[model samples]
Target: MAFVIEKPTLKDIAQMRALVSDEVKRGVILERSEEEMANAIRSYHIVRDGGEIVGFCALYVYSSSLGELRSLIVKESHRGRGIASALIESIKIEARDLGLEEVLVLTYRERLFQKLGFVIIDKTLLPNHKIWADCIKCKHFPICDEIALIAKI
Candidate 1:
């Protein structure tokens, strides 16, 4: 099936929220309340596989200089189908359009991200709260064990 990627509408928030939160529960991504996702619908994107919302990603821009790739996930059945990679490229395009100099991710998928052009980095080098804002909510916060990775956009 051809997967179509685009920004999520307010109407798409509920299903999108379920997919994202499910990923969090699986430890593939971080937790986000549906309320929070609803509040930031414009920042999220969904990949429709012939009308099924099988994948989604979000780019939370901090400024012209930086952005964070948050809540990236693909339906489990669709894993290895390039679904996540496509969603990631979509976010990179968004960052480039905003003239962001850098985009970062806090993830355990080190090899996967590295193949996508992300480089491991000292978490300390991230922009202030760039890690903290979300990390603080993470159960692993303050003692976050996720690896920090960045890809200069």
Candidate 2:
């Protein structure tokens, strides 16, 4: 199957919300508001097959030297078909093109990121002021178990 991966537009927000909301319900990801997704639509990339969205990811740039990969989700039926890998590669390319020095990710899927050249790192070693804003509101806040990984772009 072929998948087209590209930045999202306002019209794609609804489908993106549905995929994300499903992942939230499955407890595989955090909940995100459609309004917020739409507002940051430029940061998102999606995989579509025959005009149907099957996956989505976002690269959150904090500075020219720093970017974070977030909101990676693939439809249940489409998992393990390399959709996630493709999305990650796309973000890496975008990060490099934007002159980002590195890209970081906080995720439970440690092995997946590792296979993509990301190495486990001390979260504190990175400047993540913006991450804390979202972290504070997370249910797993103080005891967050997600692993932090970074890949030099």
Candidate 3:
């Protein structure tokens, strides 16, 4: 099967929301409202298998020097097909094009990120703004179990 990775269109909002909502319910990702997804649509990359969205990822820039890789998910039927890896690669290219120095991720899939050249890092090393802006809103706030990782662009 051929999978195409590209920026999402406004028309993709509904499918994107549905996919994200599924992951959120499974506790695999945070819940993002439709408005939030629509507002930040430019930051996302999606993989389409024919007409269906099979995977999704987003890059949230913190500064010229840093970006956070967020909301990576692949449809369960498409797992192990390297769709997630391709989505991450797409995010990296976008980050490099934006002149970002590094990409960060707080992930439960440490080994997968590490395989893609991300290294484990102390979560405290991340910027304070990230903590205040997003982490604090996370349900796992004070006891976040997600491991932090970074990959230089």
Candidate 4:
């Protein structure tokens, strides 16, 4: 099957929220709301196969030179086909275009991200105020098992 990556639109918010919630329930990503997803829709990139969304990722810019990749998810049936990789690449390109020096994520898929050039990082060097703010509400906060990683843009 052929795949393409594109910026998600408002029309895709509900589908995106569904896909994301599925991943969260499966422990692949964090839970989120349609409002939050819609608010960030312009920063979200989705991977489509046969014109249906199969995967997605978002870049939330924290500073002029920094961004955090949030809520990356691939459909269960479509995993292992590089759809997630395409979504990530789309975010990386956006970071580059935005002149960001680095992008980071709190992810369970450390190996997958490492393969894509992200390296593990200590939370201290990251923007704690920004991440910690949202993380405070997370069920996994403080004791989050997710690995923190960053890739230079």
TM-score to true structure, per model:
0.90, 0.92, 0.94, 0.91
- Report every candidate's CA lDDT: 0.81, 0.86, 0.89, 0.83
Itemize residue pairs with steric clashes in candidate 2.
none
True-vs-predicted CA distance for residue 74, candidate 3, Å: 0.2
lDDT of each residue in 73-103, candidate 3, tens digit only = 8988999999998898889999999999999
Q: How many pairs of residues collide in each model?
A: 0, 0, 0, 0
lDDT of 4 by residue, 93-133 (tens): 99999999999998888998999999999877877686657
Tell me how far the alpha carbon of residue 78 in candidate 1 is from the true structure, in angstroms, after superposition: 0.4
Please give, for residues 90-146, the per-residue lDDT of candidate 2 as tens digits.
999999999999999988999999999999998787676855757766666678788
lDDT of 1 by residue, 1-61 (tens): 3557887777777777676776677666777777888878888878887766888878888
Model 1 alpha-carbon drift over 4 Å, by segment: 26-28
Ordered list by TM-score, greatest first:
3, 2, 4, 1
Query: Which ten residues in a row are the worst by lDDT in model 3?
Result: 19-28
- Alpha-carbon shift of residue 79 in model 1 (angstroms): 0.4
RMSD of 2: 1.6
Once superposed on the true structure, which residue ranges of model 3 sit more than 4 Å away at CA?
none
Candidate whose TM-score is highest: 3
Which residue pairs collide in model 3, if any? none
**How many times do residue backbones clash in model 3?**
0
